[model samples]
Target: MQQHKVLLLAIASVLLAMVTIQSGASIAKQLFPVIGPEGTTALRVGFSALMLWLVFRPWRHLPKGRNWRAVIVYGLCLGGMNLLFYLAIARIPLGIGVALEFTGPLAVALFSSRRRLDLLWVALALGGILLLLPDMRSVDALDPIGVLFALAAGACWAGYILFGQRAGNLASGGTTVALGMTVAACFLVPIGVFNAGSALLSFEVIPLAIAVAALSSALPYSLEMVALKNLSAQSFSVLMSLEPAIAALAGFILLSELLTFTQWLAILLVMAASLGSTLSTQKKPAAAS
Candidate 1:
């Protein structure tokens, strides 16, 4: 009874987090025309760090010794992931960009698996990527540069996962994230300032930036932490597999972006691969037990 309710709540929290994050990305995209992607990344990451710091007060539990290195690297990965993702979405459809960036985590999951079943998931992911590749014969081919940027962002996401684990072990989840966001802001905010200059300080930009920060980072992170407390990691990863589809819907509703049949199929394949990887990984432990 109580456990069932908790599971339901965790599932809902993860779903809501996906929706909120995608909606935030859509809103962040709106800022690009006004401040450019560089400026938007600055405002989003910088304001996110501020909001996280206020809530977590990570300064009260600072990382000690070698842990600082882990947090720093985690922060760098977070910043690079955001920056590259923004650059990717600026050129490509938001859904496709998200799907591409998702490959990073997918690869991380698949590569770490020693089971033969994992090979099928890897193949599915590769097929999806192949479908997404720029084909000169196709009129609707995606921008190769944008695809590369998204792939790069996915790589950063993988790094974020690797380093974040180490950092998380050193402190509470909130503290690690808060500290990491601060570090991200330290470096990323300057690039935005250099690109957008005084315009970043405009009354109009600040409010929207705050909204972006809250929707994209603060609120979603808090909700995910709630979900994490209740859900097993395998279950969490399975639920997260839905992110690309949610991103597609958000992109369509907010940005009026549409996907072709092929693109939609690609997204589905990637989601399937992600789901398969999670399920297979769970099976391994169960069989051993």
Candidate 2:
């Protein structure tokens, strides 16, 4: 019964985290005109790093010895993921961008498990993504560059997951995340500064930037850590698979962006495949013998 309760709480936490993140992303989109996507990425990363430092006091638990390598790689992945995602969304709709970015984690999950049934899930996910691809003759298709950027972000996300696992072994989750974010800020701040120039420092945008940081990074990250404590990775992945849909809804409600029926179906197919993959893995552990 206790396990059941924890699982329920984990589901709620991850759902809430997804909402917060997508909502934050919608809010960030509004700031694009003022700071551009690169600038927004910088503000979000910079503010998140600052907030994480204040909260976690990472200085007290700095990476030592060989541990620095994992932390560095983790941070670089985090930086690349955020920067590329922002760039993708700047040109593409938020929902589609998220759906595309998800391919990375889905790929990681598919490759990590040896279950034969996992291939079906991969096929389904790939089919769904293919459905979202720009039609060769349609002038209204999404920007090709944007799609490529989101795919790159997805790749970075896979790296972030792998590197994060290594970094998790070296320090507390919070400390690892805080330090990783700091390093990410180091990588992005210069690009933001160069792109946005003095505009990034505008007093009017500070509060908006802070809010984005809280919603997109600090709050969601904390919630995910808590959720992870009670949920198996399979369950967590299944729950997280709901994010693209949530992002689509958020985009519609907050940004007036609407997805076509086909796009919505594509998102559903991906979600179904992800959930199926998790359920299949749970039912058939590799060491069942």
Query: Global lDDT for candidate 2?
Result: 0.90
What Cα-based lDDT does every candidate model obtain?
Answer: 0.94, 0.90
lDDT of 2 by residue, 100-188 (tens): 89888888878889877898999888888888888868977878899899999999999999999999888888899999999999979
Candidate 1, residue 8: how far the Cα is off, in Å:
2.0
Superposed by TM-score, candidate 1 places the C-alpha of residue 25 at a distance from the truth, in angstroms, of: 0.1
Clashes of 1: 0
* Model 2 segments more than 4 A misplaced: 1-8, 286-289
The model with the greatest lDDT is 1
TM-score of candidate 1 versus the correct structure, residues matched by position: 0.98
Q: Give the clashing residue pairs of candidate 1, or none.
A: none
Query: Per-residue lDDT for 49-148 in model 1, tens only?
Result: 9889899998899977877999999999999999999999999999999999999999898889788888899999998998998897877889999999
TM-score of every prediction relative to native: 0.98, 0.94
Q: Lowest summed lDDT over 10 consecutive residues: which window, candidate 2?
A: 280-289
